[model samples]
Target: MAYTVGEMARRLGVPASTIRYYDKEGLLPFVGRSSGGIRVFTEKDFEWLRIIECLKKTGMSLKDIREYIELAMQGDETIARRLALFRKQRTVLETRMAELQQTMDTLDYKCWFYETAAAHGSTEGISDLPDEALPEALRPVRERLRAAAEAETEEV
Candidate 1:
């Protein structure tokens, strides 16, 4: 079913101005216009919008997104190019996820550290505690943090 730009924006959970901005940026080439020249979106357009949102989440620039859209408009010949783009994006996202996981691990270790210290009423000797004193899952994180601190100390 055809939907007006406002209807499409509401359904997509974006502002109407965002939909208009996407159209202005040439990202909504698949969108049609009504007899009165108002933007009209179809179900297929919703699918495209979802893809655009996915790419945006991957930190893709609007220029790259526009290129991807243009390549998509070129039909089966661009299939390989699209696959390469997605593969590259997947790798980038994987690296980001790994880094975020490491950060979360560090945060988890810190939470445990502070909670333990708070229970003891002092941070004294906490950092010097044996690895066996830490939760098994946090042992590696503690080691990593220690190694990082040692490296910084040596650098200074």
Candidate 2:
């Protein structure tokens, strides 16, 4: 069924402007237009938009997406290249998810330590924290934040 841009937006739960922007960006090749120049989308077009949304959510830049579309426009000749791009994105996403999970685990450990220390009235010195204390990944982030705060205070 043919749907207006607004209808497609409502159906996809995205803003109409986003759909229009995608059309303008050549991300939607089959988007139709009415005599009055309003975008008229079809079910197939919405399906393609859903794919575009999924790609965007995977952190694909518009330029990369455009490149992928261009490759797609070339038919099956670039299938290998397209697969390589998707595989690379998948690998990167997996790495990031692992890192985030590690950080979360470290934060949870730190929270447990704090709870235990607070409950035990051990407010003496924090230097006795276990040698394995904070995860190496989080130490740099905390250091950077502390540095930024110190710099901000100096700026004030």
Candidate 3:
């Protein structure tokens, strides 16, 4: 089915301006114009927009997204290049997810430590837990947790 730009944007939960921006950036290859120069979109447009949203969410820059779209418009000639680009993006996102997971794990551990220590009324109990008890990557979290715990004790 065909849809106006505003209708499509509403359905997608994105700003109409963003849709216009995508068109202006040449990311929408089949975008059409209405009689009064307004934008007209089809179901395929919405589908493509969803793909664009996914790419953007996966951390692709607009320039790269446009390049990908340009290559996509070329059909099968660039399929390998597109696959390679997406693979590279996937690796990046995976690395980011790993780092974020480590940070979240560290934060969870700190929260648990603070809760437990507070219940016992002493941050000193955590002193001998060893500097490298957790990942070296967690050292920063440990320091932040220690400082926060100390500050809380002082406030008490």
The digit string of per-residue lDDT tens for model 1 on 1-156 reads 999888888988989998899889999998898988988889999999989988989988889889899999999999999889888889989999999999999999999999999999999999999989999999999989989999999999
Task: Give per-model TM-scores.
Answer: 0.94, 0.72, 0.78
Per-residue lDDT of model 2, residues 1-156, tens digit only: 789888999999999999889878888766778899877888888788888898898888888788787888799999999999899878878887888876786576567557757977884654355535655655555555457789999999
Q: Flag regions of model 1 displaced more than 4 Å.
A: none
**Arrange candidates by TM-score, highest first: which order?**
1, 3, 2
Q: Rank the candidates by lDDT, best first.
A: 1, 3, 2
| Candidate 2 steric clashes | 0
TM-score, prediction 3: 0.78
Off by over 4 Å in 2: 121-156
| Residue 118 shift from truth in candidate 1, angstroms | 1.6
lDDT tens readout by residue for model 3, 1-156: 779878999999999999988988888878888888877898888888999999999898899889888888889999999998899889989998998986797777777667757977987866567766555766677787678899999999
Q: Lowest-scoring 10 consecutive residues by lDDT in candidate 2? A: 123-132
